[model samples]
Target: MFGSFITMLTGIRILKNINKSLLGIIKYEKPIDKGIEIAGYDYDSVQDIFYSNMNAWQRNMGYSRLYDEASAPFGMIVDCEPIYFKYNNRIWLIELWKGQYDLNTGCEVGVYTAEKPILNLPEVYKYMFYNCASDEDRLTISLSLKKNGKTLFALDDKHWWLAGFKLGEYSEPSELVMYLNITLKDEEMCSSFVEAIKKIGYEENKEFIVNGNTVGLTFDKPHTTQPITRTEQTDKIIQMKNKLLCDKYNDITRVYSNLTDKINAIQKQAPEIYSEIVDKAVLRKYLRSMKNTETE
Candidate 1:
């Protein structure tokens, strides 16, 4: 009976271990099987599946690795979902996945049609050009204008600079009347910028409508340099002499006041020592006489 009881416990333990193993297998099953053709090409790994759908340009632009890695999976199983967005009067789908397989890890995004037999879809050329124009230091400035509820055109960062002008925008309503402002430090730079814009068919202070908003370009010219006449030069010289004399007099008065304060402090802190330097009665009489003269 003792031997039978031990054999029964051993059988129970074996069953429990088998149950745990099966549960783990079901929990961590690979979502995509090996040799699946989700991207129109057979892929054994998630990255392979993602890259197979990307075109040469997208691959070269490094869109495959542009995803948040902290949320990536650690094991073989991956979570994939489709994101739908409308652009240019057409609906598009993006398949995004996150997981790890062997040494490969992180998330990836790929564009495809929403229908079955998924084929790779390319991003809009204008969006792609503007978005990818940024560098490590300088971000590309872009303006998107829509006319009659449709995209008219987009101006990227290099466009204004190439036209030999720097543009700035204002948020205040008063300044917003001149929507795009071209401000240069000197008159020469302003003139050159004006010429450059005129070459491109843009007129100064011309009003146009963009996206139902009245848009206009305004130029801010620097203050002009003026020549000084002989009389003005003489007046400026006299003003400078007066200012210097006043400044010197003020400095001397400040020094005298500071010395008087120090002497008074010394007299209070060490009266006996101060008495050896000068007679207190004589000092007070002299200060009083000077004060009377100043009042007169």
Candidate 2:
């Protein structure tokens, strides 16, 4: 009976050590990224700069969260200050946040319209998307936006004129929403974007809302298109030729000499055909055969 009691004590001690080790990990080993750091600014300076320049709504929201002393048990809560930059002669604001349980951070970017009209709306849209996206996300976002030669507008560039967008977070959808600024002028760019949104199957008052030049748009139901494939034989030939040139060969000069001889042989074999035509045909056939064999 005493031996059994000692065994129970030893098991309890083992569990206690394990529990202590887990607690240490939970306290110190969080997966959060290093906190935000802006160039040429300390922590206190960053806070002061953001607070002084923020709009009333932004000030209220930031301070309310900043001063909150609520306990967070799941993940560490951080109060990050907004950062500013100048693009297209306008001051742009970027606000970052990491919630108590959030594994990844979220950000909202905004910029007031320039006094003068923007010459290129598509360029601005591309810049905004890229600025907010991470390095890994840039290519994906670019391909999605540029798919099928479509911009923010379904219509061609000639048809659209003025366009602006605002980015912010929404609670109900729990995602970033783009609020488009539409103008009533003849060259207004907003109507086309709205029409494009409709074409993609978004509904008014359901997926989006418009309030006097500001259209709050949600992208819950995204439109998918078949991935673009290179179907041109010429393009494929060029790619194969490039690959062949880049490939490691024991004698690159000898390979080129062989290719030239093959071209000459094709010219000799098809004397009736134009010299240019014979040369191109031989090169294309050789590259195509090489590509096929490589695939095999």
Candidate 3:
């Protein structure tokens, strides 16, 4: 019975993982590099020269962190900046690389002109990225998760720079992006898509109806502020108990002062629910605070 319950929990987590991946880009056997003036040069020779340098780096243990998951195996290449430098002779090389991948695959995609992850991730509940451990620059990750606005789990660990996620079968073409999979729990992860949704600039406290062309949506909100967290629920019940006890004692903790004493006073009092509730509340509060700081 115990093992079965654990297995079911594991399966539920896997379902979430599978569903989230549906939002990422997918391709294979394709180096995402494009638009370079290896100009007037044979493609074969350029590829060979690239490999020669790559082989030397591999021999020097430079790519040792190739399989690192902290290395954002998936992300989007958002920029391409040009640069020129001179050593023995005048030479031009793209100095910035900017791309995105599934942080677990260690693949570089998008349009990186030789740049890497420039932002820190304090809350990584829903994404993976390049994490590195180098004698020089280090890779680090600090992110948290909040599902349905409730803290779930967290960690603050240093990782090496990463590249991409492992290639899986493509479900759709590049045109139909899986809409940035953000769970109700991922309050922050869906920001990009959310902004896109807002860009339509058509809020309808009243409907903006188009006779035969425009679409429709309503923006009436139907919820209250600060919905009860699990801890809040637990806190409410405890507050009730404390108030009842205080009133009975004419304002003294004396009523439950011997609560633990009573626990031992009885043969088996089912392990005082009040103590269990309070302990849980305290631990959860601490953990939630930690997770919140991780993103900040």
Candidate 4:
């Protein structure tokens, strides 16, 4: 009974509304030349996507989860080479550089991180996701270094996540496990949610996630030219209709505002003309009265 109680107190508990975004898991190394293929993922699986993210993040500044918006392909962030954004605030998040390679080895090196870009991104993401001030989740990693025959590469870890996480698929693994406890608030917010999924289990070499409840990308990552639910075309039509309506509304509003501004400017710049128009109308009324008396 005592042991059971302790296990309840100490067991792994994931947070409520456990978003994949708030959790970032990186698996990296001295990069496999972008030529070495990962069995489960893609060629760009380990490289091309970071460039995509850098481009998107540059344009949007950040995304809004409240609107179900994410930078379209989120997994690409994983392909980034391990780098620390230069600033302390940016340190928490990972970056994808446009360039890398060792000058000494001529191994086609990867890109290095720029200082300012690094500084802004971490804070930008932290602000966007880690909104509350409560104690954040942190991971402690344990990895062992090995060599494969004559090849001087780190073994057991096929890859790593960020500067903090290391994972290997073909090679042996230096395992990583996280230690976290649910806060009182986290527990309160998710009691029923917790009850529904208490039976959920974690598997070994099974591609576990940084967030406790979710599963890692094991053998079955999907690829599609479009969304999974194609039958929702009708619903999507409705949504499109709504969006067009909103856009039209916004356009009309902008036109109205611009016209109002022009009118205000005309009034301000030509007050004399406005007064003359009003005065002429009054003078015409007097002339009509005089003409009526003469005709009578």
Best by lDDT: 1
**lDDT values, one for every candidate:** 0.27, 0.26, 0.22, 0.22
lDDT of 4: 0.22
Q: Please give the lDDT score at residue 125 for candidate 1.
A: 18
Clashing pairs in 2: none
Better of 2 and 4 by lDDT: 2
Residue range 1-296, candidate 2, lDDT tens digits: 44334334443443454444334333422201011111011112211111111222121111111111110111112222232333344323222222211111122222222222254343332122212222221110100111122222111111111111111110111232233322222223335445655654668998766665445544332342211221245334443432332222212222433433433443345332222222222221121111111112
lDDT of 4 by residue, 148-172 (tens): 3222221111111111211111111
Best by TM-score: 2
| Model 2: CA > 4 A from native | 1-35, 39-102, 105-187, 224-296
**Full-model lDDT, candidate 3:** 0.22
Clashes of each: 0, 0, 51, 19
List per-candidate RMSD values in Å.
36.7, 29.1, 24.7, 28.5
* Candidate 3 per-residue lDDT over residues 101-145, each given as its tens digit: 111101111100112223422222112221112323221233222
* 1-296 per-residue lDDT for model 1 (tens digits): 44334334443543465444334433433312211121122222322212222222222232211111111111112233333333333333333333222112222233322222123243431111112112221212233322223332223332111111010100111111112322232444344434434543455445222221122343221111111111245434533433443333333334433434533544455444333223211221121111111112
Instruction: Compute each candidate's TM-score over C-alphas.
Output: 0.17, 0.23, 0.16, 0.17
**Could you tell me how far off, in angstroms, the CA of residue 35 lies in candidate 3 after the best superposition?**
60
| Candidate 4 weakest ten by summed lDDT | 99-108
Off by over 4 Å in 1: 1-75, 114-296
